[model samples]
Target chain A: MKPQGIKVLQLMSSRINKYLIISLQIGFLFGFYLVGGYLQKTLALPVPGSVVGMLILLIGLYLKWIPIQWISQGASALLNHLPLLFVPVTVGIMQHLDFFSGKSLWLVPIVLVSTWIVMGATGLLGQFLANRKEWDR
Target chain B: MMLLQMFFWLFITLLLYVVFRRLYQLLPYPFMIPVLTCTVVLVVVLTSFDVSYDTYFSGGQWIDALLGPAIVALAFPLYKQRKLLNKFKVEIFATVVTASLLGILSGYWLAVVSGYNEMIVSTIISKNVTTPVAMEVASMTGGQPAFAVIFVMIAGIGGAVTGPWLFQLLGISNFLGIGMAFGGASHAIGTAKALEYGEREAAISSIGLSLCALCVSLLGPLLLKWIS
Candidate 1:
C-alpha cells in the first residue's frame, strides 16, 4: 500500500495488459482461420482455407468491421517469421529422394524455365498496360 | 515425458533457425536464406542422429500450424494497398491470370515432352501457386502432394533469387510489374524477396501471389481433367 508497492503493481498490470492485447490479436487471426476451414469443408470450395480466411479478413477490413491496429502487430509478427513455418515442410523433401533420381532429371530445368517465362510474360504485360494507361492521360 | 521431449527438440529447431537467420543476414547471400540453411542443418542433424521426420514433425508441427494464420495475416497488407489495387485491378488480374496459365501450360508440356509421367507433369504445373493451394490442386489432379511442394519450393526460391536480376535485364523498372512478376512466378518466397525492394513492391507482390493462387486452384483441376 506504499508508493513503491503501488508503482510495481501498475507496471505488472501494464505488462499483463500488453500480453492480453497480443493474445487477443492472435486469437482473431486464428478465429478467421477456423472459419475458413469450416467454409472449405462445408462449401467444398476450390480455394484453400487460408486463402479464404485472408479474403474474409480483407472484407472485414474493407467493411470497417475490424480495425487495423487490432491485428497489425500480430499479423506483421507472423508475416515476418513466415519462412520459418515452412522449414519443416522444406525438410520433408528428403522423403521424396527416390523421385529425384533418373526420371526426374528435368525437374530443375522445367521449373526454372517455366518460372522465367511466367515472370517475363507477367512483367512485360503489366508494364505495357500501365504505360498504355499513362499515355491515355 | 514425450511431450517434454517434443518441446525440447522443437525449441532446438527454433533456436537453430534464429541463429542461421542471423547468420544469413550477416552474410547476406541468396543461398544462405534462413529457411534453406535451417532445413539443411536440421536435415543433417536428424540424419546424423538417425531421427525420423515423423519424430521431428511431432515436435515441429507447432511451427507448421502457424502457416495457416500467417497466410491469413496477408489480409493486413492487402488492406493497406486496397487503393492501388483498385486502380489497377483489371490489368493486374489479367496479367496474373495470363501468366499463371502460361506457367502451368509450359511446365506441363515440358514435363510431358521430357518423358515424365502424368503425375509428375500434373504436380509441376501447379508449382507457381503457394504451397497449400498447390498441394490441394495436386491432390485433386492425381499428382503427388509432396512432389508438388518440392516443385513449388524450387519455383519460389528460383524466382526470388533471379527475379530482380531478370527484371533489370529486361528493363522492367516499374514496381507493379516487378512485383507481379515475382508474385505470379514465385508465390510467397518471391513476395518476401519483393519486400526488400519496397513496401509498394511488396503489396503488389502479395496481390500477385493471391491472385495466382486463386487462378491455379480454380483452373488446375479443370485443366488436368481436360488434358487427361
Candidate 2:
C-alpha cells in the first residue's frame, strides 16, 4: 500500500476505536437508566432505576451478549471517579446538620461510629466466609 | 459572593478529581487514598468556611444526582467478570449474608454505647446498603431516612478505604472472600474499588452488596419490629 493510504487507514482505525469506547460507556449508562425506569414504571417497585439497570446489565454480561474488555474501560474510569461523584452528596449531608439539631446532634457521632464498625465488620465476615472449606475454590 | 461560593465548590471538586487522577497514575495504592483525602479536605474546607451543611448540600446534591448513573454503570464490570461469578455464586451469598449481619449489629451497638439516640442508631443499622433499601429499613424500624444517607455514605467510604487492607491483614488469599466482603460492607463504593482488582471480583461484590442490602432492608427491620 502507498504511504499516504497507510497513514489514512491508521487515522481511521484510531478514530473508530475512540468512538467505539465512548459509545459503549454511553450505552451502558443509558441502559441502566432505561431499565431502571421501565421496571419502576411497570412493576411499581420501590427499587431505583439504577439498581434495576445494574441487575439487567449483570444479566447481559452473563448472557455473553457483551464482552468484558468492552465495558471494563469505561466502567473503571467511572469507578475511579466514584469518590468524586459523592462529593456533592457529602456536602449535602453536612448541610443538613440543622435537621439533626436538638436531640438530633447526639445522632452524629453515634451514626458515624456505628456505621464504621458495621461496615468494617461486614467486610471481615465476607473474608471469613470466603476462607471456609465448602466455599473454597 | 453566593455565585462565587458555588463556583469555588465546583472548581474544588473538579480540581480534586484531576489531582486524584494524577495521584492514581503515580501511586501504587491510588484509589482509597484519593477518596479519603478528598473527603477530609472537603470536611476541613466546609468547616473552615463555616459553610452550612444545607448550603453545601444544595450544591452537592447536583453531584449526588449522578450517583445513580455511576452505580448503574457498575453493570459493566459485573459483565466483564461473569465467568468467575458463575462459578462462585453460592459462596458469595453465604459470605455476604454473614458479613451483612455482623456489620449491622456491630455498627448499631457501637453507636448506642456512644450515646446516639434511637433514630440515629436505626439509621446506622443499614448504612452500608443502598439509599433506597436503607431508607426502607429505616422507616420500617422507626429510624429517620434522611439521616440514613449520612450513615450510608460514611459506611461506604469506610468500607472502600479499609476493605482491601483488612483482607490483606487477615491473610485472605481467596478472591471470592475478598470481593464478597467488600460488597457486604461497602455497597457500591467498595465494589467500585474491587473492580480495580479484576472484573470477576467487582461483579461478585456488586451482587453480594445488593443482595445483602435487600435482605437486611426487608428482614432486618421485621426482626427489629418483632423483637421490640
Question: What are the per-model DockQ values?
Answer: 0.71, 0.42
Second chain only: TM-score per model? 0.90, 0.84
DockQ of prediction 1: 0.71
Docking quality tier of candidate 2?
Answer: acceptable
Candidate 2, Cα interface RMSD:
3.2
lDDT of each: 0.85, 0.68
| lDDT per residue (tens digit) for residues B109-217 in model 1 | 8898888888898898899999988998898888999888889988988887778778878999887788899889999888777777777777888888888898988
**What DockQ does predicted model 2 obtain?**
0.42
Alpha-carbon shift of residue B57 in model 2 (angstroms): 6.4
Tell me the tens digit of each residue's lDDT in model 2 across B1-228. 777667667777778767865776688473435566676677778888887766666556656656776777777666656666666667666666676676677666777677777776677778778777788778878888887777777667766766666666666646676667667767776776776777667777778776877668666776555533
Model 1 chain B: ten consecutive residues of lowest lDDT: B192-201
